[model samples]
Target: MKFAKYGSITLITFVLVAGIAIPLSPSPQNWLQFPVIPGLEEKARNILYHVPVAWTTVVAFLVSTYYGFRYLKTRDIDYDIKSVSAAGLGFLFCFLATVTGALWAKFNWGSFWNWDPRETSIFVLLLIYGAYFALRSALETEEKRATLSAVYSMIAGITVPFFIFVMPRIMTGLHPGAKEVADPAAISKAQAIADSAIAVGSKTFADSALATVAQMNVGSAVPVVQLKMSPNMLVIFLLGLLGFTLLFIWLLNVRVRLARMEYERSTHHE
Candidate 1:
C-alpha cells in the first residue's frame, strides 16, 4: 500500500511533466521531442491521462469481481466491504473515462458523442454498473444484498471483457484493433513510422492501455478511430498506465478501510 502510494505519485508526476513539456514536432530531431503522428498531433498527449484512467476502470471492476467471488465462498462480510468498495471505485473511474473520451471526441470529431463502437460499449457498461448500485440500495437485508450483488458482480464482470475487448475488435466501426481501420491511406505514413519504430526493437508498450484517439478518415465527413504513436509517446504512456494502476490500488485500500469503519460503528450501535 505504501509503495502504491509513493510510486503512483512519482510516476504520474513524471508522466505529466514529460507528456506536456515535450514538444511535438513534424520531424523530431532527437529523443527529447516526439514526432507528430499524422492527424493526432498535439491532441495525442491526452493519451497520457485518459487511457490510463480507463485502464484503471477495468482493473477496479475486475478486482471487485474477485472479492465478490471471495465473499460467496467464505460468507465473510469483510469481503463484501472490499467488493463494494472496488465497485464504487470502478464506477468513479468509468465515469472519468467517459468524460475524458467525450472531451477528446469533441475536439477531434466535432461532437462530444459519436457513439463510436468503443464509446457505445463504455456507455452500456456505465448503465450496467449503475443498475448494480441501485439493486444494492433497494435491499435492506445485508446478507441478501451482499449475496445477490456478488452474483450480479460476477455476471457483470464476465461481460466486461466482451464489451471492452472482443466486441470492439469484431465490429467494423471505429477504434483500432477493429476489423477495419476505415481510412488506411490517410495514416499510411504514420503507420509506417510506428512499424519502423517497432522493428527497431520498440514494442507496442501497452496493447490496451484503455483505447483512445482514433485516426480520422480523410475522405469522410465523419470520422473513424485508430492510433499511430511514436516511441517517445509510448514511454510516457507506459508510465501513465503504471501510475494509474497503482493509484487505483491505493484508492481501493483506503475505500475498504473506510467502509469497514462505518460497518463497525453501525454494528456497535445495533
Candidate 2:
C-alpha cells in the first residue's frame, strides 16, 4: 500500500516535471532534448496525462465488473460495495480523461468537442454508467439494488473495451490512431503496410470500420498507445501508465473502505 502510494506520487511528479519543463528541440545533443513532431508539437504533452487516465478508467471499470461478478456468486454485500466504489472511481477517471483530451483537441483541432468517434463512444460510456448509479438510487431494498446494479455493471463492462479500444480505432476520427498522422515518422511500420491498401485509392476510413487509411492500424491491439516516439518520450509515457495504474489501485482501496463504512453505518440505523 505504501509502495503504491509513494511510487505513484514520485513517478507522476517526475513525469509532470519532465513533460512540462523539458524543452523541445530539433537537434538532439543529449537525452534531455525532445525532438518536436509537426502535428503534435506541444500538444503531445497531454499524452502523459490523457492516455494514462483513459487506461485507468478501463482498469477501474473492469475491476468494478469483477467485483460485480463476485457479488453475484457469493451474494455478499461487501462485494456490492466494492463494485459500486470502483464504478465511481472509473467515472471520475473517465471524466478526467475527457477533460484532458478536450484540452488536447482544443489546441490541435481548434475545438474542445469535435464529436470524434472516440469522444462520442466515451460520452456514451459516461451515460451508461451514469444510468447505473441512477438505477441504484431508485431502488431502496439493499438486496434488490445490489442485484440489479451488479447485472448492469456486468453489461456495462462489456462495452468498456469495445468503446475504448475497438470502436475508436475501427472508426475514423480526429483522435490519434483514428485520424492520419501528418508526420509519417510518428506512425508504426504497420501503418506503412496499410499504405498499400491506400494505394488502391480506398482512403475513406470513415466509410466503414474495415476501410483502410494510412494511419488507421485496425490490427493493433493497443492502437491508441502505439505511438512511435523518441526513447525519452516513450519512457515518460510508459511511466505515466504505470503511475496512474498504481494510483487507481490505491484510490480504489480507499474508496471501497469508505463505502463499506457507510454501508455498515446505514444498516446499523435499521
Candidate 3:
C-alpha cells in the first residue's frame, strides 16, 4: 500500500512536469504541417490533463458499480463502503474533467457553456450520482441503506455508457468527436461541395454535403474517434494515466481501511 501511494505521488509529479513542459506541435507557416489540431493549436495540449481525468472518472464509477454488485451478492457492508467511497472520488474527478473541458472549450470555441451534447450528458450524470448520495443520506438502517444504495448505484450505472458514449454521437455539438466533422479540411471540402451543388442546382446542398462526407469517410464515429498523438505526447499521456490509476488504487485502499474501522467501532458499541 505504501508502495502504491508513494509510487503514485512520484508518477503524478512526473506527469505534471512532462505534461506542462512538452512542446505542442507548432503552427506551420504553410499547409505541409498541422498544429496538434488545426484550430485548437496549443490548447490541444489540454488532452494530457483533461482526458486522463475523464478516463479516471469512468473507471471510478465502474469500480464503484462493481463493488456495489459485490455487496449485493455477499451482503458485506465493507463492499457497500467501498462502493460509496469510489463513487465519491469519481464525482470529484468528473467535476475536474468538466472544469477542464469548459476551459478547453472557452479557449477553442469562445464559450464556456455551449451545452454541447457531451457537456449535457456529463451534467445529467452528475445529477444521477448526486441522487445516489441523497438517497444514501435519507436512509437510517445499515442493512436497508446498503441494499437500496447498491441497487440505485446499479441503475445509475446503466446511464454511464449512454451519457459518455451514445448521446454525444447522436447530437450535433461543438465538442471534438461529436456528431459533426468540424475539422478544418473536412469542413472546407463539405462547403465546396455544397457551393458547387447550389451553382448547378442539380442537387440539394444537404445531399451534396452528405456525399462529400461519405466520400471523406466523415461520420459520427469520426468525431469521437481517438486523437492520434505524436510519440512524445503519447508517452506523457500514458504516464499520466498510470499515475492517476495508481492514485485511485491508493485512495480506495485508504478509504476501505477507514470504513472497516468505523464499522467495527459502531458494531462494538452496539
lDDT of each: 0.77, 0.75, 0.74
Q: Indicate whether candidate 1 or candidate 3 has the larger lDDT.
A: 1
Better of 2 and 3 by TM-score: 2
What is residue 49's positional error in candidate 2, in angstroms?
A: 0.7
RMSD in Å for all candidates: 9.4, 8.3, 8.2
164-220: candidate 3 lDDT, tens digit per residue? 788766655655566664455555555665565557664534453444444335554
| Candidate 1 segments whose C-alpha is farther than 4 A from its true place | 181-226
Judged by TM-score relative to the true structure, which candidate is superior, 1 or 3?
1
User: Per-residue lDDT for 103-221 in model 1, tens only?
Assistant: 87655444467566788877987887899899999999999999999999888777777876787665545455554544454344334444444455434311111122233334343
CA lDDT, candidate 3, residue 150: 88
What TM-scores do the predictions have? 0.82, 0.80, 0.78
Whole-model lDDT for model 1 versus the true structure? 0.77
Most lDDT-accurate candidate: 1
Of the candidates numbered 1 and 2, which has the greater TM-score value?
Answer: 1
- Model 3 pairs whose backbones collide: 177-223, 177-224
Which 10 successive residues of model 1 have the least lDDT summed? 205-214
* lDDT at 42, model 1: 80
